[model samples]
Target: MNRKEFLAKLGMGAAFALTATCLGSCSSDNAGETGDVDFTLDLDAAANAELLQEGGFVISNKVVVAKNSDGEFVAATVVCSHEDLEQIVFQNNIWRCTAHLAEFNQQGEGLNANGSNGLAIYQTELSGNMLRVFS
Candidate 1:
């Protein structure tokens, strides 16, 4: 190839490489979690103590933390399966995704109006002042 054509091709290739690298790093890691969702939060403080109440929920970092009727903690992704919207809230012990009226149980087994897959649930361990949530 001519020198000018070779240089142009090289520049295009470099641009493509840079774009690929940026896109690769842009993929959502979602709250600094690895492939596994092992994360911990200190919920024993007065500010966070609201999570212990029945039907209470705290949403942060793409995850929803809620307490069931039995005062047990449950964790799940806040994204609604119906439209992938992050409008999840807890009310009356049920997780309702306000984006499209999708609802899930304490075990995250409920479904959206379209009958698609339910919310993704994470296992929670509440001990002392630490709450560890994982899947």
Candidate 2:
């Protein structure tokens, strides 16, 4: 190839390589390292029957603790399944996603157009007044 043509091709190749590298580094998945996220909820303070009846349900970016009608305490992640956003809010005994307005029952069942892919329900164990949640 001619000198001018060879130099132009080399420059174009370098530009493509640089663009790919920059794009790879800009991914949201690389924002942080995923680690074990474990949290404890005070069942007495969080999952009382009176509160559930009064507030309907409790949804927060933080872990939610609630007792079913069977008197069993339940805890689960409040993170939204759609976009990993903390959009779940507790009102009227149901969990609702603020982002897409998707609603879920206390059991983490989706109740809207975004059904099927529900909230992430973590395993919970109660020890006295505290409920521990783990993946």
Per-model lDDT: 0.69, 0.56
Q: Which ten residues in a row have the lowest lDDT in candidate 1?
A: 26-35
**Total clashing pairs in model 2:** 3
Candidate 2 global CA lDDT score: 0.56
CA RMSD of each candidate after superposition: 14.2, 15.0
lDDT string for model 1 (19-87, tens) is: 665454333313222236777778876756778688777875678888888888888887765546678
If scored against the real structure, what TM-score would every candidate get? 0.67, 0.50
Q: Provide backbone clash counts, one per model.
A: 0, 3
Tens digit of per-residue lDDT, candidate 2, span 21-125:
545432222111123446765546744434334453454335554555555555446566645566566655566666556677767777864434666565667
Q: Model 1 reaches what TM-score against the true structure?
A: 0.67
